[model samples]
Target: MVLQRLLLALINRAQLVERLAESKAIRRAAQLTAFAVIKGRLAGKQASARLRDSDTARMMREEARRMPQSAADAAQTVSRIRNTFMKEVKEGMREANRQIKDRK
Candidate 1:
């Protein structure tokens, strides 16, 4: 009877260990999934930023071609354009962040 009790105890311990390992695997999977999601979001954000930057650069170049002859006037125009572009980019990033958070 004692030997039988020992065997039963060992079986229970083995089952507990298995359960623990399974839980760990589940947790790891969840973590990996979260990482993947965040990574994807970051990649998307980077892509959008790149596209926006390219568009802004093109617009700036076009504006520069039409800029006034005076250095001060040209500088002011470029600064204004840059400020507007940056403001739009910031708003876009905020919106993206909100969407990402909502997804989570």
Candidate 2:
């Protein structure tokens, strides 16, 4: 009973804080910050994708493994390589963003 009452009090306090934060000034400031961060992220994804390492060692290994190494096979391998690379880069960027946000 005591614990339940304490939890309810904490929940009520949290709701009060949320309501206070919904004021016009706070909302506008949050909106502006959200827009700026989103713009930065879009730009970052583009720039990061462009600067991605085309010379990834795993790509080379997979290319070397392609036995007949026909043009079609090479193209497929390249596509696979790019997909893997992009997944890695995006994961890294996500971690970086998380760390940056946590720091702030």
Candidate 3:
């Protein structure tokens, strides 16, 4: 008996819904709601795209600034290594000279 009442109520509600659907005002409201949803989605997409573009630009700029500094650092490291090697060669030459003089 309870199930029968619920089914009857749903049938009545469905009939009322059909009648309401035929009204121009209801149709207009639905169209407006759809447009609002579409507009909101479009705005969100545009903002997300802009944020991605800005982030890419910032990253490119940072890379550009780092290039020269990294090159300079590499050059400085090479110069230090060369200086150390030359000093070692000179010290070895002096030790060799001392040994030769003592042998003579």
The model with the greatest lDDT is 1
Task: Estimate, for each residue in 24-103, the C-alpha lDDT of model 2 and write its tens digit.
Answer: 98899999999999999999998677556444655667578767458887688778878888887888799889989999
Of candidate 2, the 10-residue stretch with the lowest lDDT total is 50-59
| Candidate with best TM-score | 3
TM-score winner between candidates 1 and 2:
1
lDDT of 1 by residue, 55-75 (tens): 576678878689587999878
**Model 2 pairs whose backbones collide:** none
The TM-score obtained by model 2 is 0.41
The candidate, 1 or 3, that scores higher on TM-score is 3
What overall lDDT, based on C-alpha atoms, would model 3 receive against the true structure?
0.73
How far residue 89's Cα lies from its native spot in candidate 2, in Å, is: 1.0
Candidate 3 structure quality by residue, lDDT tens digits, 57-78: 4544554565545777767655
lDDT of each candidate versus the true structure:
0.83, 0.79, 0.73
